[model samples]
Target: MDFGCDPGEWTDAWSATGISHHWALGTGHCIAELKALADLMDVEFVEVDPA
Candidate 1:
């Protein structure tokens, strides 16, 4: 699944559905922080070209 820019707000949604992986495009500003949050949730984080 993909959580564009609201990863934090979507945590509950992700957990409810048992999602463990996601792609976050155009997250250059907070990629590191997002990755850390994903790690805390035991989810895999992938980066992709936003273009």
Candidate 2:
């Protein structure tokens, strides 16, 4: 779980969506909120060090 800015949005629950690994994906989620949720789920959010 990388704590980085990945572009994604939540689609409909009724409809099934296929996974795509396109380079031009759209971003619509709040990173901070996602981090908090991940923490509650006991998931490690690791950020890559640019150094």
Report the CA-based lDDT of candidate 2 relative to the real structure: 0.46
Q: Pick the candidate with the highest lDDT.
A: 1
| 18-46 per-residue lDDT for model 1 (tens digits) | 75465454458888898888899998778
Per residue, candidate 2 scores C-alpha lDDT tens digits across 1-51 of 332334232333212455444212223355567568669988765543433
Candidate lDDT (C-alpha), each:
0.71, 0.46
Q: Per-candidate RMSD vs. true structure?
A: 8.2, 11.0
* Model 2, runs deviating above 4 Å: 1-29, 48-51
Residue 39 C-alpha lDDT in model 1: 93
Best by TM-score: 1
- Residue 31 of candidate 1: its Cα lDDT? 82
